[model samples]
Target chain A: GIQVEQSPPDLILQEGANSTLRCNFSDSVNNLQWFHQNPWGQLINLFYIPSGTKQNGRLSATTVATERYSLLYISSSQTTDSGVYFCAVDTQEGGAQKLVFGQGTRLTINP
Target chain B: GAGVSQSPRYKVAKRGQDVALRCDPISGHVSLFWYQQALGQGPEFLTYFQNEAQLDKSGLPSDRFFAERPEGSVSTLKIQRTQQEDSAVYLCASSLGGRGRRETQYFGPGTRLLVL
Candidate 1:
């Protein structure tokens, strides 16, 4: 089993601010993903970056597989982006693509 | 085209009663997963299914918890003799991974369960 730790457990930002969340894993993982849990509790898939970098509008993610770490960047944050952002990892030996999740970074974007 | 959908959105059950939650994965997706999320916490893995076969259920909290994906598409999680500790959000996710490491898991809205 792999252990995942997220930094800055809690964050508060004003609209239009920028924030960066980080995730670090204990072991080598082949896949890493970023998710956003909205206020209504829906887990929205944000990025599926196993390696390299990807961007979707105001959200972007970068995973350095060699370093066993990943970062999620929220630029010009909006109130709608306020929620729990999670990072999950899939180890090389896990069965059926089972994902082990981190404790999550709770972000509050105030208007 | 459809994403993962969960039923009953919310459930309230008395302690010691049984409850069943359902999840409908996306069409043509081959991998399914179930997770339990406590308040203000990330989702914890509960089980994994490949088609109709369950590959990993080690994350199940107790023997009273069981899940099945008989048709390889829709899955059900049944909790017998539930207790107050069972209160949490049950999340279901599905991906296109068949055998290898494909980690794109599209999640559902999740079913919030309350045991009193």
Candidate 2:
């Protein structure tokens, strides 16, 4: 079983500030995803980057598979971004393709 | 196209009672999965189904937990003799591809179960 760890378990920033969240996995992974769990508990998919970099609006993610780590960056954060950000990876054990999620980073933005 | 949808967004069960949760994955999705997320913790895999065949269920905590997908579109997860520890948010996810493919999984609004 692979272990996923998210850094800065808690983060707070001004509406116009920027932040970065990191996820480190103990083993190699075949798929990686980032999600934002809103206050209503919906897991909104943010990115599906197993490697390289991708940008979606104010959110961007980069996964360095060789280093077994990934980074999520939020630029000019908005108050609506307040919620839990999760980093999940698939080790593809026995071809099951189940995702293993990190403890998550709780982000708060002040308006 | 609609995403995955779950029924009875919340449930309350007493100890020793049996509870069933339903998951309606996106139409034509070949893979479905179930996960459990405890308070303040990340979701953990419970079971997985590739079409009508359940290929992996090693993540199930115990024999009391059961999951099935008879027709390969909709699935159900049942817990027999639920205990207090069974309280958690049950999530259902579906992917467009079968095993070994790198596909994005879309999750439904999870069903929050509280066992008293």
Candidate 3:
């Protein structure tokens, strides 16, 4: 089993501020994704970057597979972005599409 | 549905009671997954299905938990003799592909289960 750990378990920022979140994994992964869980408990997929970097709107993510770490960046955060951010990984050992999720980063962007 | 949908949104069950949770994945999606999330915790893998066949269920906590996707489109998770520890949010997700790592899993709102 692979272990995934997220840093800064709790975070708060101004609406216009920027923040960085990190996720570390103990094993090699075939797939990695960043998700935003809203207050209503919907897991919204943010990025599917198993490796390399990707950006979407005010959010971006970079995964350094060799280092077994990934980072998510939120630029000019909005109040609506307040929620729990999760990083999940799918390892090669499990070919059945199971994902190991990190503890999660609880983010609060205050307006 | 365009995305994974789960029902009922919330459920309360007594100890030793049996409950069934349903998940409707995206049409034509080949991979379906079930996850459990405790309060303030991230989702943990519970089971997985590739089409009508359940390929992996090693994440199931006990024999009392069971899942099936008979037609490969809709799936159900059954928990018998539920205990207080069974209280958690159950999530369902679906992906377009199963083999490639590029597959993106779309998650549902999840079902909140409270075992009293």
Highest-scoring model, lDDT = 2
Residues B24-67, candidate 2, lDDT per residue (tens digit)? Answer: 99999999999999999999999999999999999899999999
Candidate 3 lDDT tens digits, A1-111: 899999999999998999999999999998999999999999999999999999999999999999999999999999999999999998865477688899999999998
lDDT of each: 0.92, 0.96, 0.93
Better of 1 and 2 by lDDT: 2
- Find the candidate with the highest DockQ and give its number: 2
Candidate 3 local accuracy as lDDT? 0.93
Question: Per-residue lDDT tens digits of candidate 3, residues B43-87?
Answer: 999998888989889989999999999988999999999999999
**Which stretches of model 1 miss by more than 4 angstroms?**
none
- TM-score winner: 2
Candidates ranked by DockQ = 2, 1, 3
Tell me how far the alpha carbon of residue A100 in candidate 3 is from the true structure, in angstroms, after superposition: 0.3
TM-score of candidate 2 relative to the true fold:
0.98
Q: List candidate 2 segments past 4 Å from native.
A: none
Compose the digit string of candidate 2's lDDT tens values, residues A1-111: 799999999999999999999999999999999999999889999999999999999999999999999999999999999999999999875598899999999999999
lDDT of 1 by residue, B1-116 (tens): 47999987999999999999999999989999999999988899999899999988999999999999999999999999999999999999999877585758999999999999
Per-candidate count of clashing residue pairs (backbone under 3 Å)? 0, 0, 0
Docking class of 3: medium
Kindly provide the TM-score of model 3 when superposed on the true structure, using C-alpha atoms.
0.97
Docking model 1 quality class: medium
